[model samples]
Target: MEKVRATRYVLPLREGGSMPGLVEADDDGMYVVKFRGAGQGLKVLVAEVVVGLLGRTIGVDVPDLVEIELPPAIARYEADEEVQDLLDASLGSNLGLDFLPGAFGYDGSRVPDAATAQAIVWLDAFTANVDRTWHNPNLLWWHDRLVAIDHGAALYFHHSWPSRAPSPERFAAQRFDASTHVLADVAGTTAVAARHEELAALLTPEVIRGVVEAAPEEWLETTADLPDADAVREAYVACLGARLAAPAAWLPGADR
Candidate 1:
């Protein structure tokens, strides 16, 4: 794992959802840091780190993410001189990173063409991510590439126990049923299937292992102990393969 220079700075983006801090690191450059506030338990943080690793290994264009070690005193320093100066000069609230300096979305007048849209849909289905939609796309335009952010919802509601009986209400554990609009659109678009197959090779056990190995120690202890890299890869491959083979009438699974 490469060493990243961690600089502590309050983020200017304030989205209503996750309260993530932004950090400019020397290794990965810039990253959105999700704070594990008192309200958030270790599980959520684990989810973020694990999902991020898996997403990146599969060739998904995810933003650089890292765990920020904040001091207890820093919490009360929300009114520090530097922090106050940042808030006053910034256009939006610095409460959290809903917005970033150079980050922007696709033009409202021109949604992604069928190909790109379907690509995203296919990836989301494979990951069981329910957050992507017309509303908060979580898709950003970076250097002419579409990037996904704020994936705090994928694989949600999973059973922590190995022998737990699964139920219909078990949203996270369920496989992707093809009937969903996202799934239908994705399959119908030839571009998506072709791209999916091309990228399939990247989603390997070695890839998953690399991501897990690169993750911070605290992150591992939180999310089901990293699921053996091979197991993780196999699970994703099985889910994606099944989704691809399923009839189009099935509904795509939910993320949260």
Candidate 2:
């Protein structure tokens, strides 16, 4: 992943709870940044990188992600107390995505091609991301292409972290309810199931380990069970690998 410095806090996107901001970076690029200091904490940022990268590897349309350095000076001039506090807390590293200029939210009117829809649905099922529902589709229609965003809600198993020992077995068997998925209609369950072999081949252990390692070291919280960032990364890789190995348990309509 590329690293850039955040030059200015362009604006705060209040639509979601995390309050990811539209930031201007030293590279003169506009990015949507998900801060480390957000209420949900660093785990969400980890999920964003892992799931996003995994999606990218599997031919899914995901925005380019980068590690953005947020200097304290930008927070010093902020007028809003809440946003300023967020910036102050998130003083060092943050997650930023290449901003899509005029991307519109996904609705049924502009559904993607059948293959693309199947790929998205399969990816969501594997990651256990329930946020891609009809009510709040995290997909974007940019330049008439389907762009997936906001995977913070995907890896819910990580939130247990220090409190609960990382459970690859549990996550591996966690069933994903995709009946309400945004692309459920367009992506037939049987069709998606047929893609299991090809899609599964794309996510090798080496590939998964790299995605988990993509997260910043500081973002990975140390627990009694997971003493280091590398350990945490290994835990994620294991969980995802186990899930990939056991598709019938979690892959939606796998039995079909």
Question: For model 1, where is the 10-residue window of minimal lDDT?
Answer: 90-99
User: In candidate 2, residue 8 scores what lDDT?
Assistant: 92
Candidate 1: where is the Cα deviation over 4 Å? 1-7, 23-30, 38-40, 80-100, 112-116, 157-173, 177-196, 221-256
Q: lDDT tens string, model 1, 54-164?
A: 666665666655444443344344655644443233321111222244768744544555555655566566556776655566777766666666656665543352344
Deviation in Å, model 1, residue 196 alpha carbon: 4.1
Candidate 2 differs from the real structure by a C-alpha RMSD in angstroms, to one decimal, of: 0.9
lDDT of 2 by residue, 1-256 (tens): 8999999999999998899999999999999999999998998999999999999999999999999999879887789999999999898999999999999998788778999999999999999999999889999999978999999999899988869899999999899888999999899888999999999999999999888888999899989999988888889998999999999997767882
Model 2, TM vs. native? 0.98
